[model samples]
Target: MEPGSFWTALIWAIVPMLLLLAAIWWVDRYEKEPLRLLGLALVFGGVLAPAITYALDRAFDIATSLSSQQIVPEPSLGVGTPLVEEVVRGLAILAVFLLVRFEIDDLLDGLVYGGIVGLGFGAAANFVGIWNTPSLGSDTDSSLYTSLISQLNHVFYGAVIGLALAAVRRREFPILLGAIWWVDRYEKEPLRLLGLALLFGGLLAPAIAYALDRAFDIATSLSSQQIVPEPSLGIGTPLVEEVVRGLAILAVFLLVRFEIDDLLDGLVYGGIVGLGFGAAANFVGIWNTPSL
Candidate 1:
């Protein structure tokens, strides 16, 4: 490991990846994750995972040193190296999971965190891969390119694993829906009517809103979220969305007049509709639900 090569590799690797991570964080339109948490995840990926991977790889090499076949044919580093690296990276991704349970603002937020870990992991791996290669000194430019390609591969795999790991937060949709049901207390809306409202509010109405929004967007060149009854307003998506949800409930109320007895009944039914819509919209989920 030449000192010059190591510094060159480290600089090249860290700078580009940090920029990419910043881009990912910036492109997040709806929610901005805390920079503190993002920075923490980057550290976990770049430092912690690489150190652990090195240790594990060394241990494996030592464990297999005395093997009869000289560690060549049966279980070579080819298969084992990637496995070990990914598992270590995965552990780092898991560490990220612990940092942002409550702060995750969107589904994309989870993906951004996963991406941060991956970019960091890839960046750090380049330090090792590029420094060890003798060609890094003689063929600086080409070596840097190859190192970049390798890092991209690492980033790709790590991001994928991170995306998969993001799903493990596990939210139960019915919990809040059930709470809203409990709020009716007296003269509860019929479950049949509630289900109708839930599905219509959660699924059907949103589709209608999307179609209308898209139609306006194409005609007016406004953002999809901005295109609607009020083109000047960018919050049209939510406006239309809430109206559609209310219509679904009103449709149910009209169809089942006996069930909606008073203001309290309407409130309970309306709350359920909103919860269903929220669950589908990614506005609320298992991670953010106030269970109590």
Candidate 2:
């Protein structure tokens, strides 16, 4: 590759990853973690977690083939894909949690970890997507644009999911402990509502982005029909996704009234899960595409 092209590809890879890390940092404004651990989490979540997931996926495939359940073969989507993938990703989170339990001081920690995992996943996926595009030689501009947009979208999705997991974990713990009993009786109700808000906000970010993109396309088409054409902003979907993600973080604040520790834990955990999924998806995308 030419030096210019290599630099462009490297930038394309690093920028989205950095933006994701920054967003995760912003969400955990309450309890700031050491930069070293954060960087460590990012490296592991981005690099190692994906490799582990890939290995597990292959192992599962072999296991399924070896099993002799001829009378009742497992449905591909129901029994095979979702179950195996979820387990593989969940194990990645579990491994990190075990090794760095001390680092995960609060719900927000969960969000951070989840975000790191998602970032790693998104980076890997974007690299593959960019590398596989046949238009790279003929339509470099369009291909680069597409890669950037996809990377941002993936990062936003991962962050939202990370936030949700963190908040839920935080709430579950206080309930398990005797902390809630000492607080006002009405506190728990509000916390539960907050958790729900986070869940919905996180899950809906991608759908909202999809809707906005469709709306933008329609608007652009209508504009072209008139004498004068309106310019495309390209900001609608990302803005909406960010709003939803921010709301999730806000929900975490309102729902978890205990010490900041639980919040950090939830934040990091959610981030790890999102990261793992993003990485797995990236790997799949790479494998499916034509090599550079």
Candidate 3:
């Protein structure tokens, strides 16, 4: 690699991630975390955690390569990387959480802090990836795109774990929500409203929909006295679920029209409603899971 290539590749790698980190900072609606602590989290992710991950990765690579057995099912370098990365990164999150537990006012706070660290980690990882990319001859566009997308995957993983940790600590809600929550660009939506939307989708919509389906089943049973597939369980589910979520979105739209200025803003609400509905569905699928 050329002497200047490292700096160039590193710049290409970290800039986009820095912009994302900036966006996360912007969306942190309620309270801004301490900068010093945030920086520490960044260092832990970009420097400390990655260093540990690299060491572990190398060892794991050697061990897995030497083993003839398919120890990990997928058994590639990638299979165990998430476990190694998340553990080190989770510790980074834990340090920040411990140092500034009082600052974490809400779940979003956890999202922001954890996201920052994740972005930092992603940037470093991307730099390594880009640095190692076999020169695709003159054009670096492909390498840059691959690195950015891969960086985003890491960011999502890190953010989700962070969000889950926050949910666990507060015991407020489940992490059934998707990483799309971060897509609210400005992330101005209140977490409580989002939670409410999820509840509406999960509980009320399902209840009404299920009732209507049961009525349909009884009516069909009495008249036809026959059925294939028992009316296909929740036959009106999609329509009813959409309508219920649409109502929730409309209610939220009316309530917070100011926060949702554009289509993307509206989408954030819609997405949350969808996620809430999904979370509830998953919980109903597994009744014993209290976390759900």
Candidate 4:
């Protein structure tokens, strides 16, 4: 692609992602979180986090006899990658949680923070993906499709992560403590159950995405062979994924009646999960790009 064309396509690809981020921010209208933290999270997601993962992968390669091909082919959307990436991404939220436990106050606050972190992670990852990919000699459609899919997938994944983390924190610690406190004092039987449910759902999201991708691939192959109708996102696959995620959120909400006052906690927790999911996805997306 010409330099001019590449610039145009890049701009187009970015605008919608920004709009989506704005929409998410608008939806979370309670506390307007500082853009500085959000920016930091994005930096962490796009650069520091991916760098750390890359370093770890390299270390694994050096410590063992694993070939690049063997390591590179590790499932991108599976239990293994998500497990590792989620922990790394969660660190961003954990950092904030530690410092601001006094301000968190409610479940929804958790969701908001989680979403912010996830949005930052997703944006950084998407930016990297777009920046690294060649313009494909001016075929903007491919780039646009890639951007759209990347954005939506990251957003969804982040949301789920936010919800899961929120649920867990709600159960584990309902009140803030000073440095000397060794344990949480809240008895949260309900939130504990909700946390378990969130864990189960968060674990399942990637599995479902993988299954749907595979199913779509198979259906497309069959369609090409004239054996079935064309397979697309509209074939009930995306809906199924959404339903599963919704059920997970509902399970947590139903189980935990922590009090309306604690809504911020939920938001913050959900946001953290989203941040982790988005950061993980972003890391993989950048790492797997044609160029490092």
The global C-alpha lDDT for each of the candidates, from Candidate 1 onward, is 0.60, 0.48, 0.62, 0.48
**Deviation of model 3 at 253, angstroms:** 10
Task: Residues 113-134, candidate 3: write the lDDT tens digits.
Answer: 7887788888887776556545
TM-score (all chains, Cα) for each model: 0.50, 0.49, 0.55, 0.49
Model 4 misplaced stretches (Cα beyond 4 Å)? 1-13, 54-79, 134-138, 141-143, 168-292
Q: lDDT of candidate 3?
A: 0.62
Distance from true position, residue 178, model 2, in Å?
A: 22
Q: How many residue pairs clash in each candidate?
A: 1, 42, 0, 40
lDDT of 3 at 20: 85
Candidate 4 residue lDDT tens string, 91-150: 766665555555554555565666655555555544544554444354333334434545
Better of 1 and 2 by lDDT: 1
lDDT of 1 by residue, 164-253 (tens): 444345431223222554445445567888887787777776566556656765211112212123233333433555567668778767
Displacement of residue 42 (Cα, Å) in model 1 is 0.5
For candidate 4, the per-residue lDDT at 198 reads: 46
Between which residue pairs do clashes occur in model 3? none
Number of colliding residue pairs in model 1: 1
> Sort by TM-score, best first: what order?
3, 1, 2, 4
- Lowest-sum lDDT 10-residue window in model 2: 63-72
